[model samples]
Structures are given as structure tokens and as C-alpha cells.
Target: MNNRLFLKEVDQRISQADLHKVDNAVFVLHDQLNMQVWPEWVREEKPPLVFIEAKAKGDSLPYHKKKITYVLSSMRHFAVECQQEGYPVYYYSTDQHYDDGLSDILESHPDLVLTFMTPSEWDSRERLREVKSSFGDRVKEIPNQFFFADPDAWKDNIEPGYRMEYFYRDMRKKTGYLMNGDEPEGGEWNYDEDNRESLPKGYDVPEITGVEPDDITNEVIQMVEEYHPNNFGVLDDFRYAVTREQALQLLDEFIEERLADFGPYEDAMATDEPTLFHTNLSIYLNNGLLLPWEICERAIQAYENDKAPINSVEGLVRQILGWREFVRIYYEAMMPEVRDTNFLDFDGALPELFWSGNTKMHCLQQSLKPVIEQGYSHHIQRLMVLSNFSNLTKTDPRELNKWFWLAYVDAYEWVVLPNVLGMSTFADGGILASKPYVSSGNYINKMSNYCTSCEYSVTKKTGEGACPFNYLYWNFVDEQREAFEVSGRNSFMVNMYDKKSDEDKKAIKESTNQFLNQLDRYSG
Candidate 1:
């Protein structure tokens, strides 16, 4: 929070070619098949252009120092692709020049600078608004054709006070994914009962496709190494889907090997298992390299061709059309005000192990290692493990929020912020999630085998071998007694808290604070 240090950090990022790629595909949105006249928005604005490339406040953690370079690198590559096809392109980097990016766009005086709409940090949306408004008729925010939902689709009716189940069901009917006319294929809207099945004890994951980017990414990797030298993951291990070809190849791999079991073990976790049945597709999907529709279409093609099952295909589709789209829409409908809403009102520091990965708890240690080693963890790991722990500890939403934003590779503020503050932390009332995803170590045991060799007992709440999570869970309940007392969803927790002896209650408080006293060091 030191202003001098903060400004100094900002100054550093500004010099690093931050705006290396900023220009967008300047296009006239035309209806090719209809052969009709272009819309007034298109007509009024001569040839419209948007600044497509983005940059973050890389003044934070260096988990993916390569992340910044990847963006600039891929953008520069994308710019080349556009230019080859005779599309005028402009690009910028926040590293080399910061606000100059906006100024450069203004000098062009393009009809409308379009971008896939997103919110950065606290001031980003407002700053973008000022830039757009300052330009008067120039800045037009558009829906990312990258995602499944219509841009304004969820704006008018953001289904509040509901979890994803109902949303998933509605999306099934609307999209006709896994549907035959009006009825769902397999006579099921969701395969929840079937999907939760785990891989047999020593399950082996098939080979995954890794894309070593072309020279552009290689150059960016070199740049990140030269500048932001010290980071969590090894740069040599960096193999993100940087270009369109790599993304498509990865899509084919998962569809061929992992897609069938992906649905069943989507939420499963394990100590030794890194890429169990999960398709490491998020990195590609988050970046513009792979579009969600193409992914879904390919998976759906597999099902129709009898290569993959309806269950597998439908589950993957629901993620894109249902969960992914829902999150983006819900995020747009309820941001700014929503980010600050901490309904439970719990306040405490996060545990030290989050950054250090120094914990005796085996589950955390195993899960957290990948986050450090790769700058990526799937949604289940983010939500149910690291984030769930943060919520239960009642860590300051901002504190936990900052870590999530700083660490992950795919964590652009637009995507990460909503997932972090809204879904993971549940700071925004119940807008993104119905309840705080608080859990004891036992839940971790149920999901993964990380509990098997842990020093602490998942089965015990107190005594010499008592799990720290047991203590934390009880303390979290007691800490938020006033708010949670009325929560019917948390009634069972309250009842359990009431059943605890004073000695055990005192012990839980002591252990929980000991854990909370050291928050900054822990990422999980």
C-alpha cells in the first residue's frame, strides 16, 4: 500500500513496451449472405477500428511474468496475421508506454475503437469510460464474439438469488445442446449423478498437446526473462496456446483422448494427479487463440459422429454456453457496486501459506504446487480449494482478491475479478454464488486423495492430530455468528458450532488466528 513503491512499480511497467500491440480489426460489420446495406452504426462510422491488445498492471506477482510477454507476443503475431490478410492493424503494450496507448488511438480518430468489453482494476472501467466519452462518438464497446452469449443477453434479466443449476437447465433448452427437439438428449438436462464418478485409483491421463509458440512468443519469453527475471514458474516450461494453429491442435487432442472422461471427473482432484481427465483448455479459451464455439462444435461433432458421448459433449457445452456465458453476462450486469459487497462482513488476513506453499496440510501443498509451477489451476481448484479456504478464513476480500488477480496466467481483470470477488470469495452477496464455499478438510478428503498422508487428521476436529481446517472451519463459523445465524444454508454449521465444548471452541479460535496471522505468504 506504499504510494511511492506503487508509483515506482507503475513506472517500471510503463518502460517495458506495455502497449506493444493495441490496434484492432478495423472493419465494417456487413451482412454478407443477405447482401443488404450495412447498419447505421456501421454506415455512420466510416471504417471502424478497435484496439484489441490488452495489458495489465504487471506490477504484482511474477507467477507468469511470461504472461505479459505472451500477450504482447501473441498480439504482435495476431497483428501480423491481420496485416497478411490486408486488415489494417494497430497495437500497443502497457509495458513500454502506458496512457500513451489511449492517446495514440485518439490521434488516429478512428470511427469507433471497439474492444471486447471488460473491467480492469478499480479505476479501469471509469478511465475507459472517460476515454470513450472524451472521444464522443469514437469508443464503442462490443460483445466478444469469442463467447457464446449475446453481449446484452443477460443485462436486462440477470437471474439473481439463484445458483448455476437453473441457469444450466435453461441454457440446455435454449441452445438445444444435448437436446432432441424439446427433450434433452439422454433424457437428462445434467448428468450430475454420473459426472461425479472418479477415475479408478491409479488412473492415467493420456498425452496432452503442448504448443511451443512461434518466434514471436519465443522473443516475448526472452523479453520477460531479460526484464522480469525472477518469477514462480520456469519460463522454459511455458507452453501456452499463443497462436490459432496451436489452439486448434490442443482442441483436437483433448477431444480425442480426454473428452470422454472429462465430464465425469470435471471436479475431481488428487495429490499425484495434475491433468487427470481435465482438458487444459481454459488458457486457450481465455486468450483469443481458441474460440468457445469452435471447441463446443468440435465436441458436439464427436458426439454426433459417435466418437464422444452426449454426456461428455453436453457437459463441455454447458461450460461454454451455460457457465462461461452466464459468468460474463452476470459480471457485466453487476460489477463496480457488486465487487465491494461483502455480505458476510468477515475480515481477517489470509494464511501465509498462500504465497509460500509452506503448509503441513498435504491437500493444500499438492494443489498449490501446480499454481506456483504453472500459473494456472482449473476452476475446481480455484473455487473449492484455495478460494474456499480463503472464504472460510474470512480473509479480507481485497487481500484474497489481489492474490488471485496477481498470480494466475489467464487471469485478466475482466475474467478474474468476477470469478475472484464474486464467485470465489462470495464477497458480492449471492450474485455469482448462492453461499460461501466454506468447507472442512473432510470435503477435501471426499474430493481428493490429498488427505491420505496428511499430518493432520481429516476425521478429527480436536486433539493432538486435529486438522487445522477443522479449527479454521469452527472459528469461521463463530467469527461470523451474527450474519450466519440467520442463514438457513449455514444452519447446520451453526448447530455444529453450538455443539462444541468451550475448551474446543477456545482451541479452534487460537489455531485459526495462528493460521490467519500469516496470510500474505500463502496463495492457496
Candidate 2:
């Protein structure tokens, strides 16, 4: 009853003969659209492909308009590509839940057997399992192959007190990437120390290419607007690649133009440029349009060909082969409870500035600009600026995590939850990160030119017209003095805060309290 649109259907009512004639159907989830991951039987037998656009799933969050558009458009494109390759395609646009939508298909074709790869999301996997219960052996679930990390291997090999660096080393050894026999190629496992240079003035970043919306993407844009009018983010310049071919082209461009300088400027922020020398492949990587191992290989190839340096190549590899894989493993290990764990117990609300981008603070405004328009910004902005400010303000980690899930195009429960709760918010208390990733105006000033044009004085540490980050950071350190001392890793922060003069300490409290009160007035 909730079948909203059947965009591409070979037959409205599949015959029993049609169902029995094929070996089985492959129920391709939105994120599992890549051909490389398909079972060998699928390529030989050319099984019917099933795709469902479940409205209930989209409605679960106030997702950014562009995020929904990207997923739906990419799914639609993949379904058509499968059809061109002689696979029978059944694409359903429905207002029902994924399981419920599949139920209709099951009822229509009683002889149909559905094969699905295990979903990246925990909830989606569970829902598919529920469908399996009703139909018994009709639904077969296979392991996901889009990622380099194996979940079963992670459980067996990963020791307690899990750390990404160790896991990353093991992965490098296993893959033999950036390795000189048994040792690392550069005699070092990490080059993150060299990756913090800020962008010099008037630096010209290479222009990123965007795919023009074809008829398929244009139709998807209209459909998203019709259904999700209230969603966040603008769709004015919709430019994401909807097909694997387009994604590959973008990857090639990054390797040629950006990968060489990517390491030094990876943490840099420019007022005029949102993405500087960084590969925006996560958009494709998250949704199966791109594979993880292939992306790393391409970057390594650049290094081998002398097109890129080891710092840049290893840095990029660490992101995909190291951090990304580790986070997915962490998410799987600490789910259902990690979503709500507030280790710091800070319950302040996320400010309206995040939604409106109406703050006079230039860093917040500039950092939020790309996110508001494109549902994206680089990792540095997401961590050092957005998350730093949230931690300083004492915003509930859960609220900030939810906002991130709503805002980013590359977000999903598996990745977003761990990064937000574990890494960004420190909500899980040293589970995924050793310490809280908090910084003051000084770090921002060093990394970006946002401070140069900010309304507040970045130098002034207290009183009116002073940057709020300066006082809020000190106040957080003073307030959490006991916690830092207990942790022992960042106790120097407390020692430094203790050395401040009594008058200076008093002024910091006054400034922070005054700003928080004014913030509450407007927020309420």
C-alpha cells in the first residue's frame, strides 16, 4: 500500500516462472551497489537485482537535503547500470520501512529467494534479519566486502585497550602497502607530525570537478525536494558523482592535482577554500561507489611514480587503511550503549548558531558555510573548530552527535557514532580516543585566517569583545581539573591552569559565565 513510486520495474507483478527460472535475486542495499563485491554466482547467473528507497528510513532523521539526494541518486544510477548489464532490476520507491517494503516483494513472489550483503549499519542489518525470520531460508545474508577490515578477524586479533596505531600497523603488514619487506618504507609508521602546516595567503587550490546532474540525478533532486522540504542544507549546486565511473574520474583528479600537497595542508583551513588539497572520496567510499583498497592503491601508486611524497601518501593511506577501518571495528565493538554514553556528563544544548550559521564568530561562520551548503567540510574543521567549540560550551555529546548525523553526506550510524561519541565528544571516556580533542582560540588562530577577520579579539583572553573560546577553554580545564588529574595523560593542562593569577582566573570565570548566560537567553 505504501509503494510510492516504482521508478524502474521489469514487471509490476513478477511471475512464479520468472522467480523460479533465476537461481535467486540479489537484494542490493544502497551502500552495497559495487560489482566487485558481488558473489561469483551473481556474475555467472546474472540474478535479478532489488533496490528499495524506504521513505521511513529517510524520515528517521532531519538529514541534510544533499545527503539524501546523494544516496538516492547514486542508488538509482547503480540500479540502471545493473539493468544495462543484463541483470533484471526491481527498484521500489516506498513510504514503508525497508523490511516492510521487502515484505510486499516477498508476498508478490512467493518462490523468490533474496540474497543480501550484511549492511554497514547495525539497525539495517537487524531489520534484514527480521525479514529472514518470516521467510526462513529465502533470505541469505553475506559478509560485506566494501571495507578492508574483517569484523571477525578484528574480534579475534584486537587486544584489550584497543588503539588504532597498532591495528593500522598490522593492516599495513597484512596488505604490504608502504612497507619495505617487514619494515615501513619510510622507517616510520606515521607522518602526522609533518601534516599541520597552514595555508599561506593567496594560495590557489585546484578546482574540484563536479558531475552535472543527468536526468536520473535531476529526477532524484526533484523527488527529494517534494518529500523532504524541511531538510537542512541547500541543493543549489548539486555536484556529487552518481555513478562509479564519475567517482573514479574524481579520484584520478585528486591524485594528479591534490595528493602531493595534501599532507602539509591536511590540517590547514582557508577562508576562501573549503576543501584544500584533500580527496573528497569519502562521499563515494561510504556508499559502495568506490572501494577502500583501490583508493589506497591509487595514492600509493602516485607515491611510487614520484607524483606524490611519502608524507602525503602515508597520510592518505592511514586515513583509509588505518583510521577508517579502526573506527568501524570500534563501532561494532561498542554499539547500542556507546550512542548514549556521556563520560563527561555535560548536558548543555547545541546552540542555534549551528543551524542558522548566524554567529559573528568568523571561524564558526566559515567552518559552517560548506556544511550548510554542501553538507561537508574537511576533517580539521569538523574536529578542531566545530567539535572543539561544542566541547568548550559543555553541549551534550548526544545532541552534537545527532546534529552531525543529520548534517554530513558521508555520515552513517557505523562511522558517525564512533567518530562523534568516541573521538569528537570523548563521550565514551577513552574508548576510541586517549584524551578529549579540545583546543582554544590559539590553535584556530595558528591553523586558519578566520581569526584575522573575526569580530572578537583573539588575543584578548578575558572581558567583553574577547574570543569566547579563550575563556571557555580555561574554564573547562579548571572545572575538569580533577578529571584531568585522574586521567594523568593531560594533567599538565590542569597544572598550567593552576599557575594562572587569582585575578586572571576570576576574570575567566566571569567572562565564561556571562557569555553562557547570554547564549542561553538567545537559545531559549
Q: Each model's RMSD to truth, in Å?
A: 6.7, 2.4
Per-residue lDDT over 175-225 for candidate 2, one digit per residue giving the tens place of the 0 to 100 score: 999999999988999999999999999887998998899877777788788
Number of the predicted model whose lDDT against the real structure is largest: 2
lDDT of each: 0.64, 0.86
Residues 452-491, candidate 1, lDDT per residue (tens digit)? 8899998887556778677777777777665454446767
Q: Could you tell me the TM-score of candidate 2?
A: 0.96
Candidate 2 regions off by >4 Å?
2-23, 156-160, 520-524
* lDDT: worst 10-residue window of model 1: 27-36
In model 2, the worst 10-residue window by lDDT is 8-17
Looking at candidate 1, what is the lDDT of residue 117?
44
Residue 15 displacement in candidate 1 (angstroms):
24
